[model samples]
Target chain A: MSSNMMTEVLNLQANQLNAGASASLEAVLNAPPEARAELSALMKLAARMKRWLIPVRPSSAYRARLRDGLQLAAGHQETHRALVETRPRVPQWGWLIGAAALGSAAGIIAMILRRRQTRKDASVAESAR
Target chain B: MEAEEQLIERAKRDATAFGELYERYVDRIYNYIYYRVGNHADAEDLAARVFYRALGNIARYKQRGAPFAAWLYRIAHNLVANFHRDAARRREVPLDDIVAVAEKRAGPSQIAEQNEDARVVLEAMRALPAERQQIVILKFSEGLSNAEIGKLIGRSEGAIKSLYHRTLIALRAELVKRGAE
Candidate 1:
């Protein structure tokens, strides 16, 4: 009849479906005769759909082959991952070189200042004489 | 026996553990792909790929309260989608394939009737949207409950019910249309 009525009917059917099998059957049995037939038909349709596509087992040969392939691949992946995790961490070369250069410059500057002071002291001593 | 979660955890680092997980799910995944693609060769290829990809990414898998099977189904769903996109072609389920399935049970006359019905329904299924097709396959082929289906597809149970109801209606309409033709 009306769209809202149709929506309500569909909602009722959906609720029944979500309730699982025994409850659904109980719902169907208790439904008014007028609605029962349609609901029953829908349920039959679902069952028929299941029957229509019978689950076919994959060939044993293919299954075995795939299993072997996956095992090999997994072994390789595990090895790679282990290598990555266990590998030693390398020191950052840039920072090490920079620190060494800074130390050498500081040492040279100190030596130059000491030499200047010594020369100044010698000049002072000569003047006193 | 260790719980599935522990097995999956071990599987993340252990190849033998991963192999155990594969044994548990390979058939269901194969059947799912078979229904989707309607052929043995492609189903086999895709099913293998699903496991291979899962093995490659197992370390990234987290236990988010859903079953591990849900994760595998999600992978299968995506790969099937990609397959359709790449092929850019409609499915053509050969009669022989339907016959082979039907032959698994029933007499000759019953097999004949089943083959026709299977073909008709499969053809009608193709006309439905992709989501609807997946719902049907998960519900019918794998016998998953609506809640399980919802978990795999990342939908609420209520949403799955609504979709399932709508899907049946759509299938009926399609079947009627085909009958009229």
Candidate 2:
């Protein structure tokens, strides 16, 4: 059998052969003794491959540890999320507004002190004259 | 499956729900990693990382028409790949694990022979290219269909089938060489 035919036969066995493939694998497999032998060998190999890699369950202790770890992660994420939500949020423009308010207050206080000092200095000058 | 979807949605917000998802997929993921890595300790570590990563990123996970399990498997595939690359080494099946498997399958008289066969097969499997090894493990260990495997590996079903065929052929050749030895 051609390599393509063999591939077709194997693909059919795997159940993923393309819908539009021309040759029937069944016909090819049934045609000759040599083909039959090849099919048998391939099938046997497939079965062996399947059988050898048995499904192994993780240990119970490991399962419990994973469960604990996931629970911890979930808790961590929840806490982190809650902290983000409840933590006092300074609005994006809050700092700018606060800085402007402080600057204006400081300016007013400085102007008042300067005016008082100027008035006192003028009175002193007039008395000296 | 609808229930699972709801569970996944709940899991996105609920720790208990995420734990349930953990319970459901832990073994399958662990098994898949075990076969890929050929050991228990690394498998467990990688499997844990897969879940933690999943939980951390669950909020961003969308259905995307694939099952949640597929998402987990993809995480697992990536972790295993990194594990391999970082370790810069490939581990064959440990002899004790092979013996344990062989003991479970056959009588005492056949234990030695079965162990040998198991070792040979595992070595051959490890010798396969990374993607092909994954295909073999997903196909045989997880018992996933070609379409399902394709979904996991991002390949067309036809491509998966062809890969499987070639994998089997290479495996057979390896086994024949072992027998000759």
Candidate 3:
């Protein structure tokens, strides 16, 4: 048989083909003596593979430990979130400091302007006399 | 499926729900890892890590059309790969474990024959490529259908079918050689 034909037969025996296609292929496999032997061997191998299916489970202690670990992790996450939410916010000192500096500069400017106005008034009074 | 999704969503928020998920998938994940690592201790450690990692990232897990178990399998697969790489050695399935497994299912009259077959099969399986080994394990051990296996392995159903057929053929050849010996 061609490799494709062999692949098809093996695929059929793998039970991967659709129901209708599998039925026809099963007939084809059964019709030929060589194919029948091949199919038998495949079935035997399939049966042997089932020995691996003996469900091996982790120990009970292991399961308990895993559960505890997950709980601890979840608790830690919740605590961290709460801490973030409840922590006091630091005052923004930079903005306060900036406003103070601007106020000081405005006061200094006003004082300088007042002195200049007084000097100009004394000069005007002397000219009028 | 919808119920599982609701459990998963709850798991993201509730520890008890997550614990429920753990109970559901721990054995399947452990079995997958055990066969890959071929030892109980590493499998346990890796399985623990798999769940820890899953829980840590549970909030970020999106369904994406695959089951939550698929995500867990993917995590297990990566950790097992890393374990193999870090260990820099392929651990063969211990002969005793194979004998134990076979004896559990086979009668005393058939123990010797079944044991030998189990050993040969495991040895042959170890010789297969990692992906092929996974395919065989998922198909046989977990009893997952092709579509499920494909989702876990990131393969289409057709691709999995071809790989499985090839795997069986290789196993048959290996068994024949072992019998001849």
Residue-level lDDT of model 2, residues B79-169, one tens digit each, is 9888878865665566777776675657777988887776777777876777888888888777788898898777888888788888887
Better by TM-score, candidate 2 or 1: 2
Highest-scoring model, TM-score: 2
Task: Return the candidate ranking by DockQ, descending.
Answer: 1, 2, 3
Per-candidate TM equals 0.74, 0.76, 0.72
DockQ score for candidate 1: 0.36
Off by over 4 Å in 3: A1-40, A85-129, B88-92, B105-109, B173-181
Q: Candidates 2 and 3: which is better by DockQ? A: 2
| Residue pairs with backbone overlap in model 3 | none
**Off by more than 4 A, model 1:** A1-41, A91-129, B88-91, B103-110
Point out the higher-scoring one by TM-score: 2 or 3.
2
Interface RMSD of 3: 3.1
Task: Name every residue pair that clashes in candidate 1.
Answer: none
- Please provide, for model 3 over B1-181, each residue's C-alpha lDDT reduced to its tens digit, 9 standing for 90 to 100: 4388889889877877888898899999999888777768888899999988998899899888887888998899899888888865566666667666666666776987877776677677766777888888888777677888999888898888778888888878877877722
Candidate rank order under lDDT = 1, 2, 3
Give the TM-score of chain B in candidate 2. 0.86
